[model samples]
Target: MSSPKILSVDDSRMIHTLINKGFAPYDVQMFFASNGAEGLEAAAKEKPDVILLDVTMPVMDGVECLGKLKADPALKDIPVIMLTAEAGKENVLKIAKMGVRDYIVKPFTEANVIDRVSRLVTLKPKSAAAAPAPAAAAPAAKKARIATDAIKILVVDEHPAIAESIAKAVSKRGWKVVPCAGPAEAQPHIASTVSSEETPDVILVSLAFPGKGALKFYQSVRMNPTLKGIPMVGLSVKTAIFDQNEAKETGYIAIFTKPLELGELPDRIARAMDLDITPIFYSSEGDCQVVSIPQDLSETGSIDLTRQSRKKVADFVNAGFSKLIIDLTGVTKFEIPLIRAVASIIHECNGLDIKWRIVGDDADNLPNLPTVISTNLKVAALKELPNPFTNTAPLDIYPTRAAAAAAF
Candidate 1:
């Protein structure tokens, strides 16, 4: 059998890149189109097994493209999943009337994307569907192989089966899983903790949890000073646009569609809690020195990341490296102190006549320093770097630090 073809229609090149990486492990052919018009053309020619259509686009939007697809005799039978930033009820009804197979909101995880795509397309072989092998090793060994510290997670789901499945997956990673049936049941767990370490590192609440009370629970948590920082992710059977919008508006770090991808739950938890599983590293690629930050810097233990960054920069400068690239793609939060520290470092780099650029999505969130250049794409950052001796302005400049400071 030939590889399944997956077509993605989006105006953002970053989304296209993410889709490619999310499905890289699977056995499938991926196609890309900038807008609905291009998507329609690609659909007719490729006849892709699955289409991931973005709702908002120039020239033609996803709804229009989906309408065209459903109307076409050859493409009408193909499955299409809607992707959008808006999850309003109105949008959901509009897409539902058009017959989309499923919908995924923005800021989704790689696992979320893969899980949804798998539901719509048969990318793997039947022989690869063997039952998972049982673990013969001790739980201690599993814990040692995974996390060094015990992670505590509070799971609130009305559905017993789904909650148990989620608990089982989290337990495999050596984390402690506390299962609660509803907001009332979960209250004790949240209130019992006296300190951050004692508290659940993260909470997974089902939107449909008994009484539709997950939002109430989220509000309560946010109102409490101690629990406010503890990230919460929503799980829901409702893939409708309105439900998604509600989940996001309720301030969930992410809202995943059920059934959850058991294997990917722990990683999602780590991301939601901003836990850094690995240490940041520095490497050299040709003429550029690349410093890759950890996926979650907020969990970097007792070490002062900002100070460490300063020392690293001093060392790099002393070692005669003129061009540096700091990769912050894995970092989720950009605190003001971090911004100030980075700005100071960039100022130092400027004094040393060193050229530098930062690659990450939160660059926009960073306080713009005149000395620093940032780009959402790594290649774009690298391409735009100017020679230090030329005294020319850096390319692809972001908003200035003054503007960011004022906004803050």
Candidate 2:
């Protein structure tokens, strides 16, 4: 899951830096804006969970900015925190009526800002003050946590030391860790456990393992009902967009570089499992081919190929492309559209004349996609190919139109 993003809308670079640093302890992706207009734009693009607005700015004042943000239906749900030197009760009350989450007085302590932000981030909203007692107070009949349902985790790596390090770091967070020194060892463990009631919640795979080995691990882990929805995260010493692309196809949800700012690991892990704030990961896996759809699919190519991209995927039964290679070893959240598009295309291409296979996605992003996908596609590792094409084949999940055309 992407961190709970915060957009700091302040004319003062000092304040923006301060808020960001102070909240650094918490897992969050921070965005900065000098004033209201830029702040609004950032909010739309970043979809920040929280906004810190400065009252006085060169163009739009905080109050007016807050008004505009609340007016936009798309931005309204996001919590806004108005910051200013104004400590008057009247001023606070005024901003409060505008739906601001909380008002912070400038020249404030870092602790104050952190506390207020944390409170807002953790709270739920209500249409009216008198909304019925919260859901927690009225517990449901479902059993809360089954003993066998304890969080299941799989650690995949070629290096025993690294696998042990990750397992040690993550175990502190209360999740059960099952470490596999290589994908070969990981497969049977995952296969046997996946069909059980509670499957592993997370799989941390190292890309250094042989591509074929990694793919097999992901395939086994994802091909079962109990394990299908688990989120997989990749951990490696080297972090690159390419690495992320390679592992993304096999269904990993998030990717992180090793020597990992270890302190943040627990929080990131929690967020991935917590569906409310989870970020979407996009990958050109299966029948989902992430092309700059608006541009690559265009004739004249007037579209901004960089900003608005689309994925072209064949529906499950209709899919025919035979060479399947997915690179998800380095992927994070920006690739969600591609992931959804791939699933859609695969669904459309099912039962088609084409023989499809996949490579990469060693991290297990979409842990359960394989089980659902197996019904329609013949997924495999690039190394598993029987003939002709070899591992050297330049197949990227996020391929250029020319590259995809060449592959076809």
Q: What digit string (tens of lDDT, one per residue) describes model 1 on residues 304-368?
A: 34344555555555454566665556455644333333444455466554576666555454334
Q: Where does candidate 1 stray beyond 4 Å?
A: 125-408
TM-scores, one per candidate: 0.37, 0.32
Tell me the deviation in Å of residue 345 in model 2. 42
Top candidate on lDDT is 1
What lDDT is reached at residue 289 by model 1?
A: 66
lDDT of 2 by residue, 1-408 (tens): 555788999886456556765776666777999988898889889989889899999887778888988899999999988887989988888888899988888777667887888886752222355567676766466443321235677778776776666667657445677777877777676675445544466778876665555556667777765567767787755745566677777677777787765545654565556422111222344454432221011211111111221222222112323333233333333232333333433332232223333333333433333433332333432122122222233323323333443464
